[model samples]
Target: MWHMARPRKPLLSRARIVACALALVDDEGLQAVTTRRLAAELGVRGPSLYNHFRTKDDILDAVADAVCADVDLSMFEPYTEGAEAAEGAERAGSTDGPGAADWQDALARWARSYRAALAAHPHIVPYLARGPGRRPSQLRMADAVFGALTAAGWSRAQATHIGATMRYFVAGSALGSFARGFVDDAELYARDYPHLDEAHLLAEYQQRVDDGAFETGLRALLAGLAQPRDD
Candidate 1:
């Protein structure tokens, strides 16, 4: 009897798998990300993927962490400097501080960067409903936000609350527009909803996009948060 040659191990790695999954999500949307699909893309069998990730949910969680890692810190870097000080130290400097700034402006920039990242990976937003603690990069991202806020004359307790609020707000903001297209971005019946028709709601779909909504909400949040708190 002749001996058969064994199959070679694939060129795949966990990082490659995660990256490919993200790209698939970006191009065709998240629903396209399946182990079978991913394996096919990697030129391996679906079972080979399990050798790296246990289940689809595990892969999704990893993808969420990967998405958080992509946030742009360039805008938020200034405020994060000296952001890790103790009470009355005048700064919060930690070489490891989140996103690199120590003021609300820094936080705002950080928020925008985060929004951009999520917008790029819309499929991963739903997984964030559970919040950031589950993933290492997300938890680090959260820590940076809290650090920046606390450095800006906000208390640690207050910073935590504000950070939570911002995370929820940004996640919702990115997803809201995505949800809109889920129904229809086209015209509705003019006979129905006279007020909406009169307002030209259907025609100016692009204009209807409130690009400033995030800034407006951020300003409002900071203004309210900066005020003296009973606690």
Candidate 2:
């Protein structure tokens, strides 16, 4: 009997499909990620992709999850439980202060990191904003934020509200660039608005202007939500 030996590895996989799909999404918008286009990008046949994902949406789900995986969730570790929580809190405090880190500080770190991850793939934000769905990483992120808040003295309802609020803030921030929308035309603003004198320079310092705005807004939001709990 002549038996042919099998190849050491398969020609395609779910991970490869997702990586290619994500790259396509990052390069083009979600609409650009068709099965044919994905197969073309991966140097494989369209049928090969079917071996991994049953549909284009499934591929997108994987890509969205991959983006969620990039978000840093370590900030919530401090609010866990027991001795581990104490150590994590100490580490967080070491970064923000000499005392145990406050819940505000933990959330601030998480929000900044989340915004950064989304900013890197602004094209994918719309799809991600559709909600976590069955994405493990996205769900895990939601869990961490809610759990940390409840542990830090907030009621369950308050924790849910805070999580939703922070998510909205971060997602909105990454949806589009505020500074980049401004034009470097001092004359335009001078004749009309009469106030935006330095508006012309905003385009040149887009990063600084936008980052400062995010920090300011983030602080204000957290402070506003800091009132005594009703629940």
Candidate 3:
């Protein structure tokens, strides 16, 4: 009697490798991600990973790009396209226009989206500040921000600075752990630190406090960017 051969395991692909690496990082922080660990997670040999990635850093870069790909870049599209349309309309004597306010709105939306993406994968926050480099998703994000700003009448220099500024704010916000640092007990701060009387409140309203702070800072940054500039 002939028996059917067991179905073969799905062949490993770069996407599968990157996905497994990301899950590892998500579960156990970036340091937990190793070729051995990934291979084990994938039920493959360590050398099998090298066939897809040159080194651990290559896998990490792919992970970072994957995280960036999750960011909502659609926010920039309306403003970028609207600005272009407005410019064309202006040449045709139309009064309606997209302006600095539009750019500010788009940037604020982008900042929130960026922060949310990073917050969801806090494990990757440490690597994001290194800039997009050769990562296509991150590069696309940067290009969208730059394109929107420049289209809204910002000079190339100003657009570059704004992109950097937004990136700094979003990354810095994600890096902070203000709410998590507070203890739930009021007495924890009662003795030597009366100024910390509100410590319990922090634990009670941790998420609100963090979100409020982010929004406050984001609004302030966008407002400042909306100001008229000589350059």
Candidate 4:
């Protein structure tokens, strides 16, 4: 009797499992990611998932980490000096302390990249807002931000505030769209809402409008947090 050859690779895997779960969340919503639905999506029995993830939350945690892994932390790299930082260098008139403009440029780049990652998977934004929660990629991002800030002259507590403030702003921006909140009904807004005469056009201009808002906010935020401590 010939026995079935085990395929070169197992059909079920942690990566496959997480990918499928992420797809489920992306296609439907976070609530749609139950183990049964996930198993159905993966073409496996429900119990099969337990071999990799112990609970649904475990699967979600993995999904969250997977998203986190997409973020770019390279702007925080120390060797950035004399290259792009040099270009941004003259932009800073401050020789008062650590190069604040370099930090500002790094932050703007990081913010844009971070928002792009979260924007690609808007449905998962709620899960990500909960913070790092022991996720490796999330933890690494946090480390890079804090380390870079302190190295650039922020005290530990100030670095922590900057990190938290960035998270709040970025997460809130990614959570939903201001433009989409308005219905595209010109007639409806024309009468009662005087200022919203152009509001009806918002949804159609959603991406452009939202991108402008994020950029404006990011600029203001980086400026507000710009630091060259006196002490």
The CA lDDT at 78 in model 2 is 66
Which residue segments of model 3 deviate by more than 4 Å? 1-8, 82-101
**Model 4 lDDT, residue 129, Cα:** 85
Query: Model 1 has how many clashing residue pairs?
Result: 13
Point out the worst 10-residue segment of candidate 4 by lDDT.
78-87
lDDT of 2 by residue, 131-228 (tens): 99999999999998987887677888999989999999999998888888888788898888777877888889889988998999999999998643
lDDT agreement with native, every candidate: 0.71, 0.85, 0.85, 0.83
- Off by more than 4 A, model 4: 1-10, 79-101
Question: 1-231 in candidate 3: lDDT tens per residue?
Answer: 999787587688999998888888778899999889888888889999888899999999999999999888897877676777888899999988564356777778888888888988888889878888899999999999988877776788999998898898899888766787887788878976899888877867878989999999998888777653658
* Ranking of candidates on TM-score, top first: 3, 4, 2, 1
The segments of candidate 2 whose C-alpha lies over 4 angstroms from its true place after superposition are 1-10, 83-101
What is the alpha-carbon lDDT for the whole of candidate 2? 0.85
Worst lDDT 10-window in candidate 2 = 92-101
Clashes (backbone N, CA, C under 3 Å), per candidate, total 13, 0, 0, 0
Worst 10 residues of 1 by lDDT: 178-187
Tally clashing residue pairs in candidate 3: 0
Give the per-residue lDDT digits (tens) of candidate 1, residues 1-231. Answer: 998776685578898899888888778877899998999888998998999999987887888899888886565344455542332253444244333333667667788889888877777788877876678988878766765665555677887878888888888887756224423322453556555543344234532454566778878876776542545
